[model samples]
Target: MGGSFKTQREVNGLFELTDSARNNLKNNAYYNDDLAPTKLDERTWGTYHIAALWVGMSVCIPTYMMASGLMAQGLSWWQAILNIALGNLIVLIPMQLNSHAGTKYGIPYPVFARLSFGIKGAHIASIARAIVAAGWFGIQTWIGGGAINAALSIVSPAWGAWSAGIWVSFFAFWALNVWIAHKGPDAIKFMESWGAPILGVLSLSLMIWAVTAVTQMGGSVGDILNLPATYAPGGFWKIFLPGLTANIAFWATLALNIPDFSRYAKTQKDQFMGQLLGLPTTMAAFAFVGVFVTGATSIVYGEFLWDPVAVVANIGSPIAGLLGALGIAVATLTTNIAANVVAPANGISNLNPQKITYGMGAIITGVFGVVMMPWKLMETAGAYLFDWLGTYGLFLGPLAGMYVADYYIFRKKTLDLDDLFKGEESRYWYKNGINDKAIWTWVIAGIFPVLGKMVPALSFFSDNGWLIGFVVAMIVYPVLMKNDTSSLITPEEEEAMNEKVTG
Candidate 1:
C-alpha cells in the first residue's frame, strides 16, 4: 500500500517489504498470512500498549503464588521478594535484546530463529518453546477453572458437595481460552489493553483486604514481615542460587518467544521502555502481596492458605467469594492468552505454514494443554520450584543464549528480508533447510545441566541450570560459527541488495 519495489524503504528501524517482494513470496511453501512480515502501518503498538501487555502478563495467579513457593523453600519475606525482583532484572537484558529483532524485522519468533537455526531447523527452537508454553497454558487454565469452581460452590451448596463439578468447570474455561486465541492477535491486544488497568486495581484491592483483615484480627503487618524462615537447606547461599535460577526460569519461555509480541511494537524505545517499566515492578509488588496475604492467613485461619481461590472461599460471604473468583478469572485470562497461547500458536504454524493456519495451531496447542494434565505439576511449592522451574530452565536458558549471541554478536543485527522466505533459494536454506551447527550447539550447551540433575556431586550445575546453559551457549555457538559467514550481511551489502530488488 505504501509503495512499489522502486520506492520501498526503512522507517523507524523497521524493514518492511514492497509490493513486489510480497507478491514474489506470497505463494512460497514457507509463506502464510500469519507468518508474513508485518507491514510498516501494521506496527501500531505504542509504549503504553507494550507496557500494558507486560502488566497484563505479570499480574497473574502464578506470580501471586511465587513468593509463597520461595518462602516454603527457605526464604524469609524480604529474601523472597528480593529474589523475585533480582531474577526479573537479570532476564530483562535478554528480553530487550530479543525484542529488538522483532521490532526491527517485523517477523515472529519462528522466522527470527531462521537467522541462526536455518529455515526448517528453526523448528527445534520454536517447538521447544511451544512445549513449555503448552505446559504453562494448561497450568493457567487449571487455575482459572479453580476460580470458576469456587464461585459455583458459593452460588449453590450442592455444587460444592459434588466432586465432579471441578472437571466440568475446567473444560469450560479451557474452551473459552481456545476460542479467544482462535480469533487471533487483535483479540489478545484488546484483552491486554483493557485488562491491565483492571488487574492492577484488583491486585491492590486484594492486598488491602488482606492487610485490613489481619489488622482487625489484632495482627500487625510487621508481625508477618518478621516471620522466621521455616526450611533452610544448609544455609542461604545453597538455597539462594537455585531459588534465583528458578525465579529467572519463571519467565524463561517468554524471553525466547518475545518476538511473537514485540513484532507489533512501533519502535525499539517503545518496547524497551515499556518492558523495563512493566515487568520487574509488577512482579515484585505481586510477590509482596502474595507473601503478605499468605502470611496473614496463618493468623486469621490458623492455617496457611497459599492458593488465592481457597482463601477467597473461606471468606464465608457469598458475594465476596464470587467477586474474588471473577478477579482471578480475569487475571488468569489476561496471562494465559498472551504468555501461553501466542508462542505455541505461531511456532506450530511454522511447522507447516501453507496447510496450518494460526487458528488451527492455537487449537492444537489447547489440546496439548489439556493432555499435559497440569494438576500433577502443581502439587507443592517445593516441587513447583525445584522440579518444574529448575528443569525447564536447563533447556530454555541455552536457547536464550544462542538467540542473543546470533542476533547481537554474530550477525550484528542484520537480516535479508526477501531471502527469509525464499525456500531453497534463500541463504537460510542451509544443508537442505537445516543448520546442524545450531542444533548441536543447543544440545551441547544443555547436556551439562541435564547431567547435573542426575549426579549428586554435580547438583550445583543442576540448581543453576539456566545460568550454566546460557553461559555455555554463549561460548560454544560463536566458536562453531566463527568461520561460517554465509548468513552474515554487511550494511553495504544490504544497500546493494535493496537496489537490486528495486531495479
Candidate 2:
C-alpha cells in the first residue's frame, strides 16, 4: 500500500509539472537539444543592447508610416505622440509580467505556454503565433526588397533589371538571416547588440541632414512642427479609441512573446531594467526622431511623407537613397531574425514537445514563410493586413488573461510546476492532455471580439476587441476551471517535479 501511494504521488507530480520543468527534466529536448543550456551571461546584455533592440525594431519604415497615419487622423503631433506612448505603456505591462516568469525560469515562450494551455493544447497558441511571424517575415522581406529596388532605380534607370537585382539582394540577405538564426541564440544576441546601434546612427544622421536642409531652406523648427492634421474626426470613440487599440494590438505579437527573450536574463532585476530602458526610453526616443525627421521632410517637400524610403528617395540624392535602402534592409533583417524567427520556433517546438527541436522549429517556420507567400499578401492587402490581424488579439487576449488570472488571482502566485510534464492518467491529463473547460471558455470569449472586428454592423467594438477578449477570459477561465484542482499540481508534488526537471 505504501509503495502504491508513493508511485501515485510521483505520477501526479509528473503530470502537473509545467512545460519549463518538463524541458529541464527532458534535457530541453523539445527545443535546441543539441545546444546545451548556457547560463546566459546576463552582463553580456546591458541596458544599451536592450535599448538598441527597441530602436531597431521601432525606428523603421513601418513606424514612420504608422506615425504618418496618426497624423493623418487629425491628431496634433503631440496628441499622436501621447497616444502612442500610452498604448506602448499598456503593452509594457503584460510584457513585464511575462518577463518575470521568463527571467525566473530561463525557458522560452512555447515552453512557458504549456503552463497555461497544457503541453498538448499549447500547440494551438504556438502555431497561431508562428503563422503571424511567418506572415510578417515575408511581408517585411518584400518591403525591404522594394526599398532596395527604389534605390537601384536612381543608379540605373533600367527599371526591370534594377527590380530583378533588388529581389536578388533581398533574397541574399534573407538567406543570410536564416543562416544566422540557425547558428542559434548567440547569433541573435550578437545581431541585437550591433544592429540597433548602427541603425540609430543612420537614423540620427538622416535626421541631422533633414534638419540642416530645413534650416538652410529658411524654415524654422516651429514652422516644421506645426504641420496641419490631415484626418477628419469621425467621433472621439471612433478615432481616438481605434488608434489607441490599434497601437496596442500592433505590439501584441511582441508583447506576448517577451518571455522568450526575458527568460535569458540572469535575474528579475535584469529583466525589469531591460524593459524600463528598452520600451519607454529607447522606443520613445526613436519615435520622436522619426517624427522630427518626417516633419522636416514635409517642410522640405511641401507635403507630408511618412515612409522613410520615400523620404530618402525624395531627397533627390542617389547616394542618400542607396544608403537609406541599405539601412532599412539591415534593420529589417535584424527584426525578422529576432522577432519573426523566435516566435515560430517556439510555436513549432510546443506542437510536438518531444520531437521538435529549436533548429527543426526554425526550419519548419521558414518553410511556412515560403508557403504563406507573405509578400503577395502584403502587396494585395496593404495596411488592411495589420487591421485584419487584430482578430488574433481575441485569442491571444484570452490566453494572456487566463494566464495572468490563473497566476495572480486563482493560484495566488503559487504553481505546482510538475504535473505539466506528466503523461495520460495524470491529473492534468484531462481528456488527453487538454483542459476542455479552459478551451471552451477561450473559444467563447474569443468569438464576440472577432465578430466585432469582422462584421460591419458590430464594428463599434472592433477597436476594443482585444480588451473584450481579455476581460471575458479573466472572468470565465477561473469560474469554469474552479475546483478542478486536478489540473494543478501541489507544492509537495512540485518538489518531485523539480527533481525530474533538474535530473
* Highest lDDT model number: 1
Per-candidate Cα lDDT values, in order, are 0.84, 0.64
Candidate 2 residue spans exceeding 4 A from truth: 1-56, 159-166, 233-237, 370-389, 416-418, 425-427, 494-503
TM-score of each: 0.95, 0.85
Cα lDDT for residue 150, candidate 1 = 92
Per-residue lDDT, model 1, residue 145, is 92
lDDT of 1: 0.84
Model 2, residue 190: distance off in Å is: 1.5
Worst 10 residues of 1 by lDDT: 1-10
The residue ranges of model 1 lying beyond 4 angstroms of the native Cα positions read 1-8, 490-492, 499-503
Please, what are the lDDT tens digits per residue for candidate 1 over residues 60-122? Answer: 888877887777666788899999999999988889999998998888999998888899999
What number of backbone clashes does candidate 2 have, counting pairs of residues 3 or more apart or in separate chains?
12
Tens digits of per-residue lDDT for model 2, 394-461: 56777677767766676665443333445554454566666677688788778877787679788756
